[model samples]
Target: LDPASGRWIEDKLPIYDFETLDDFERLKIFEKPLLAALSRKSFIGDVLGKPANERLYGSLAAAAIAVYKGAHIIRTHDVPETSDVVKLSGALRSRTSVVKEGRYEVSVLEVKTPQDAGIAMRNIGATKTGSEVMQEKSIHLVLKIKNLTTTEALIIKQEMLARGGDAALARDAVSHETETTDVLVMGTLLQFGRLARKLDGQARSLPLIAEMIRECISNRTNLEYRYLR
Candidate 1:
């Protein structure tokens, strides 16, 4: 509905497929509250030249989109039907829990972060602390150490490989060309913990580097960005 014109915006109808929820995905970065009122009374019948009672399918489509786009509230004339759509769309949007194939059920788990891994572990009856620690093992991080001496870069790569992780350094580092190289350290939280501990016992700026790595991960885990309207 266009408030300025006091008329319905035909393009806003979900059946027309003009309005999209693409921006809603990016909107999550802002973390603002959203409320959507999607109901059977969207005036879609008028656009289709049909009766009011025949808009059930259009309403269901719109309601599915609302749920998938993170609507806080969904107003609907058909409560039970809309509720089912909400559940299905919400499940698909968040994660695909299960699929059936050849008389076998496959459970699909999405674990991009430690939080996601923790949830997955808990669902399988893991203890809370156990899940927490295991979740860290499930999460891998890559940190770039910039402006490092060739020796430091070589040491970093060797140490990471020793810990079952890996690091990439510039060619200059391997050739000992007296040039500083940036090292990309890749490891799970568990491997990183081991690396940091090992670095702590080493000499010459390695302890400080370990502390810096820990602090970097800590800050990332706790950081939250807020925006004012």
Candidate 2:
């Protein structure tokens, strides 16, 4: 018995859909161990009542709703069917839209020389190139820096901060306690483009890092790339 709620307790076999389940018994039956069994029974009954091909429609519908609502890692026995449903749901959710008013375009610029990169940077503006227009939007990026010392990680963080972006190092990176860590970079597309330009020809690893960022920005579905004059 629960002292606070004044509910009676009982020890009995778990049952589903009782005409009158005392509060304690109802709670116990709804627990994972008993509920799982009840769900299996219900699923089997649903399958038996439906045609062979239509047996999984209800389950697939539920899976689709879950995917559309941003649920990840759905567990199911129907992998092929569930995979198709999830893929379709994700494709629908990732659809992009254009606004006729107060709209901005995101582009990636690749320059070989510092002079060219500087010229590209100068073209970025609010109305001209949409630079600094995405103050309300921030892009999160993660990069795995294998075998980099803490000093190098700090340098990356500082460089990112100097470019109007921020970066977070893995635990103990500043204390010189970690040999390697994943760096999380947060910024808009404009900031990332500037960072990439800054990284070019700076170091062997930095150029590679810049390329990785460029590739990711290029592949993003939400953004369209255009050449800068």
Candidate 3:
């Protein structure tokens, strides 16, 4: 409706126009059973009557439960607090060790025996241990390639998927719905390393793209370990 023209507009329709309580109630019909169950619980309404701090505690508990139940990307007005809850919940749930500092600090060095030297030698192996660790970890990477045909994108995607990783062409590129000329490659460090090696001897622009990917990986690894001061 245009207030300036004093005209009732009919061209655009509201997707969700809840004019009355009845309209809103109709939307909640599907969740009526769950709502009924919650209503039966006195604790639920009791918690709702509390002050902001108490309400926030309740909300944090709900958020933790949701995260434990496999929810990701929780939307919250209290970003910092909710982030702490989620991080704590994830740490409690997952087996992976959470690194407090980005890099470990060597406060003291007690190299008293030959075994300690051997341990150090093992730690500093011939190959880059950092790269090896990155490969072993379930790392995910997204690479965007521009100015590529659908066929070329599919070839890359197929190669990546065959090597236990996954890749995809831009949504429109697959069905030719639109003129999208890009490919998105997803893989771990090892899979990407293998792909780059395979691409090295290939003809045309593949080798170029491969080199670009290698450079990106190298830069990422360098950035990751740059905090080891």
Candidate 4:
């Protein structure tokens, strides 16, 4: 790594393939923090014909995307602004919370799947059966659903909220001013499963929605090979 820029300076310095970088799971293999650099002198600034001093917003936007793409540390000249961007971007990537009092501490864990929760539970010597049951409840997911009837969106929001989860619906859906609205559903695997099962018994297009939710969860958990078949 170059000390001046905190990035590798090699023969291919001019070309950075961010999409390729994002696709690779370096953290899973090396257990090392990935540091990403966002600079005013980057190609983005060049494309905008902006000087270093005038590229702050572009750099901040890059930094936020970097965080969402799994960069643990962001190397940027603008510390205060970048810090806010990082925090917000990270929150969007996953919901996290922390609490500390004296020597006791509790925090919401970030697990990508039930398998990840199972591994963590095993490490802590939790019972296999108990772990298997709790694992599905431990991981959270956020799914954005598009093109739903306003009534469907409103029902989804109410159902999710009643199930200890939540759904964000467009304001027009709540006000019944729009025919269709988009919704963002947030819940654990167990809650989602329950929601799908409940929706299966509901009238209208809800049975179809239930099927879609089941397919979504299955696809998410096995995306690497789901398309191969």
Best by TM-score: 4
Candidate 4 has its poorest 10 consecutive residues by lDDT at: 1-10
TM-score of each: 0.54, 0.39, 0.38, 0.55
For model 2, the stretches where C-alpha displacement exceeds 4 angstroms are 1-147, 222-229
lDDT of 2 by residue, 15-119 (tens): 211211112222221222211111122333333476434546655765565455334445565778778987996676542333444567544332322333333
Q: Of 1 and 2, which scores higher on TM-score?
A: 1
After superposition, the stretches of candidate 3 with alpha carbons farther than 4 Å from their true spots are 1-137, 175-180, 223-229
Q: What is the C-alpha lDDT of each candidate?
A: 0.69, 0.51, 0.53, 0.73
lDDT of 4 by residue, 1-229 (tens): 2112212444423223332233323233233577766667444454467878899997887778777856788888899989999999888875347799999989865566677677778777898898899998987889889999988888888889989999998887788999998899999989999999889998889899989999888976453434232
Which pairs in model 2 have colliding backbones?
Answer: none
Q: Ten consecutive residues with minimal summed lDDT in candidate 2?
A: 30-39
Kindly indicate the candidate among 1 and 3 with the higher lDDT: 1
The clash count of every prediction, one per candidate, is 0, 0, 0, 0
RMSD of 4: 9.3
Top candidate on lDDT is 4
Candidate 1 lDDT tens digits, 140-184: 899999888787778878899998999998876798975788889
Per-residue lDDT of candidate 3, residues 1-229 (tens digit): 1011111255522211111111222222122221111111223224357644455665566556545433444555467888898887666654323345667643322232223333444554623554344433345578888887666676688789889888767788777665547777887667888898888887667888899898886764352333222
Q: Relative to the unseen true structure, what is the C-alpha lDDT of residue 193 in candidate 3, on a scale of 0 to 100?
A: 85
Model 2 TM: 0.39
TM-score ranking of the models: 4, 1, 2, 3
Question: Could you tell me the lDDT of residue 82 within candidate 2?
Answer: 74
